[model samples]
Target: MNCLIIDDEPLAIDIIAAHCAHHSDIKVIDTCCMAMEAFQALHQYEIDLIFLDINMPVVSGLNFLKSLKEPPAVILTTAYPDYALEGYELNVVDYLLKPISLERFNMAIDKVRQRLALPKPAVADTASVRNLSAAQSGPVKNFIFIKSNGKLVKLDFSDIHYIEGMKDYLKIYTHDKVHVIHQTMKNMEEQLPESLFRRVHKSYIIALNAIKQIDGNCIETEKGGVPLSSTYRDALLKTIEK
Candidate 1:
C-alpha cells in the first residue's frame, strides 16, 4: 500500500514512517508537513492511505479531508481524543492517538488492508482449521494474533482476563502482561466469539470464564475488578445463565 504521511510535526511523520517500514507491503510514497503540500501529493501520486494529523496550521487535517472530492482511506493521527467522533463522522479508516505504537500502527494498517480488499499477511493456520473441522466435536479454535511491540503476538482466549477500551485503542489484559492494540470496543466485540466473551460495561469486556464474582456493579477477575454497567447487566446475567 502506498501511504502518505501528513503532519505538521516532523517527529510524528518520522515515527509513522518508521512503523510503516516494518510492513513490507506498505511503502512511504512521500511526507508532507502542511495541508497544501499534501493536497498536491495526493494529486500527484496514486496514494492508497494517509496518516493525517488534525491540528495542522492553516487548513486543518479534518478540513483538508473534507475538501477532497474522493479521499483515499485515512487513519487520523492526532493527540486530541476529542476529535475521534468527528473523525469517524468523516468516515476515517481508523483514529490513532499521538505517540502511536508500532502495534497500534499495524492494527490501523490491517483496517486499511480490509477496506481496500488487500490480502492479509498469512497469520491463521489453515491446517488447524481443517484438523478442527475433521474432529467435528471439539472446542472451537480460541486464539488470535495481535500486533505488539512491532511483532505479531499470539494470544489464547483463555489467557485474557478482560479488555479495557480506551477510545480508539484497547488494552488487553492477560495473565502475563497487557497488550495495547488499536481497535474500537465495537470492533473487538464483533471479532471475539460471543460464547467466550461478554461486554459487561461500555468500556470493558470480560472473558466469561475469567469472572470470579460479581458484586454491586463490579465483576472480579484474577487481575482486578471490572465495572459491570446496568445497561449490559441483564444481558450478561442471561448469557451466564445459559
Candidate 2:
C-alpha cells in the first residue's frame, strides 16, 4: 500500500515513516509538513494510507483529515488525549500516542490495513466444511516460531503458560523464557487453536493445560499471573465447574 505522512516535525515523520519503510508491503511516497504540501501530492498520486498528526501549525491535523472529500485510511498520531474522542467520532482507524515503539506502530498499521482490506466472507460448500472439520479433529501440533530481536525461538504450546499484550507486542510467557513478538492480541488468538489456548481478556490468552489456578480476574500459571476480563470469567468457571 502507498502511504503518505502529514506531520510537522521532522523527527516524528522519520520515526513513523522509517518503520513503514521496513515493511515491504508499504511504500511511503511522500512526507509533508503541512496540509498544502500533501494536497499537491494527492493531486498527482494515489495514497492508500495517511499517518496524520493532530498538532500542527496554522491548520490542525484533525481538521485537515475531516475536510477531505474522500479520505484514505487515517491513523491519528499524537501525544494528547483531548482529541481522541473527536478523532474516533470521525471514524479514525487507530489512535497512537507519542514515544511510539516500532512494535506498536506495526500493530496499528496492520490493523488499519486489515480494516481497509476486509476480505469478503467465503461462500462455504457443505462438502468443504465437512472435510475441514474432519481434518481439524486431529491433534494438530501446537507451536509458534517467534522471531524476537534477532533470534528465532521455537515455543512448544504446552510450555506457554500465558501471553500478555503490551503496547504494540505480546509477551509470550513460557516455562523457560519470555519471547516478545510484534503482533496484536487478536492476531495471536487466531493462530492459537481453541484446544490449546483461550482468550481470557481483551489483552490475554492462556493455554488451558498450563493454568495453575484462577483468582477473580487473574490467572496463575507456571510462568506468572495474567488478568482476564469479566466477560470471560464465566467461560473459565465452566471448565472448573465440574
Predictions in order: lDDT: 0.82, 0.75
Minimal lDDT window, size 10, model 1: 129-138
lDDT of 2: 0.75
Clashes of 1: 0
Clashing pairs in 1: none
* Tens-digit per-residue lDDT, 1-242, candidate 1: 88899998654664676566556577778899899999899989999999999998999999999999899999999978999999999999999987677678889999999999998765436454334233431455577666677566778898999999999889999999999977667656644667799999999999999999999999998899999999999999998887
- lDDT by residue for model 2 (1-242), tens: 77898988654664665456445466677889998888888887899888999998888988898789898899999978789999988888888887566678878877876888844334446455334433433445556666588565667787888889986688988887788876567546645667678888888888898878888777887777778799888887786564
Worst 10 residues of 2 by lDDT: 129-138
Runs of candidate 2 exceeding 4 Å displacement: 118-242
For all predicted structures, in order, the TM-scores are: 0.51, 0.49
Q: Which candidate is the best by TM-score?
A: 1
